[model samples]
Target: MGFATKKSKRWELQQLTWTFISIVMFVPLPVHIFPFVMLTQAKKGKIRSWYIAGIAFLLLELGLFASFVYFFGTISQAMLLTLTGSVTSYIIGNGLLLNRAKPYLQRLELAEIRPLAWIPTASSRNKIQQLPQAALDTPQLFIERLIHWRKEIDNRAIHQNIDKIIHLFQLLEQNDKMEAEKFLVRHATVVNVLMKYDEIENSRLYNSVTAESKKKLEDVIAKAAIAIEQEVTNQFKSGILDVSAETDVYIQSLKNRNLLNE
Candidate 1:
């Protein structure tokens, strides 16, 4: 378990390092984005069906009903033809863009963004073989892969490693706690103490927090293994602190297990 923790921390540091590098090189995007995600719906485009429909009706009416209006002397026919032309053009453009062109353009955009290439080409698209071994072997990459595995374990309906142990401690949702312990060894006490949100008042650690003077310290542990204390606290204040609880557990558990004697 101590070995696991060391490996995970090493992996985390490598990831943060790479992320900082990528930001220095690549176009900027927020490291965290859930709050801004909801803002996506707020943006409205300039184009609308009413405009297209109006164009189509004008063109078609001039060709079709204009002649009829001239012969029959009924402006009503011209008006009907104009409306039809506008609607038909709008429907055609909207259908093509929404159903066919939109998806194709998106696929092209994704392919263009593939590693080591700014202008996407066929060879660059979805090419995993080009990645360097060092990039794959980096601690950050390893930790991300570990997280993926942790999720897979969760999906299998069993509790194993730090994830399940934390789940058992949370006591917030319906889950087979005993069943999880059947598959994995849960030895991380830090996680257990952190998850005791209800029992926070009873814990000495909870009472010791200086910044949180008024509210009972909400005992918590994030499973994402985030290292930066300030960043984690900011996320907590904003109400969406996604982090790794097991990172702390991994270290403390290692010390307890005598993996780090000093």
Candidate 2:
């Protein structure tokens, strides 16, 4: 089977396991077991797991309601408890747990670098061409691609510098400076250099010429990483100055209005 098919099957199996556990454990005592299961699944960083847990909870609740109505001939109190539990679980799971888990999940996804599937004889040109244009355009996608490239290179120094560059890009994106024209140009330039390095390192003919080109590209990559770091530092410094100026203006206004002591 293909990679996507394998991945889908794996997810299905996981969901099935969750469904079984949730129903088996929760059908008897939902109040005690449901929240625990939800919390556990939520921490796994899979939103689908949450949905599976919820559906199982509903099935359990339906079963309980039926049992109550059949035995006691009244579901008024049982229904009330069921409604309260469902609402509480929804609020706590969806509003609180999922919200808290999303950022952590996103970071994990961003940090994961998947390997490329290609023959060893594939040309560097073909390898570079395989990279999607969309990946290079978006900051998050570009960072992921950079991580994959970093893994391909065996140099420790290059790895450290690339890690710094990736961190800086993330910082800039958090500060909303990723789309600035200068930064965009710099990002594109760094990607180009890395692509060239990937090409040189993976070339079939590794003579002195390729070796020299590889060394030059490594130096260029190191320099580009440093430049990106410096750019991020300057951007942060500018933000600090802007915040300080605003704070000073606010303080002055407050003093003029006697809202604060001079």
Question: Whole-model lDDT for model 1 versus the true structure?
Answer: 0.33
lDDT of 1 by residue, 23-96 (tens): 23322131212112112211111123323443544454355445444546545866666556544544543343
Error of 1 at 56 (Å): 10
Which sections of candidate 2 miss by over 4 Å?
A: 1-129, 132-135, 177-182, 204-206
lDDT for predicted candidate 2 compared with the true structure = 0.57
lDDT score, candidate 2, position 144:
50
- CA lDDT of every candidate: 0.33, 0.57
Worst 10 residues of 2 by lDDT: 113-122
lDDT (0-100) at residue 77 of candidate 1? 62
TM-score, every prediction: 0.18, 0.50
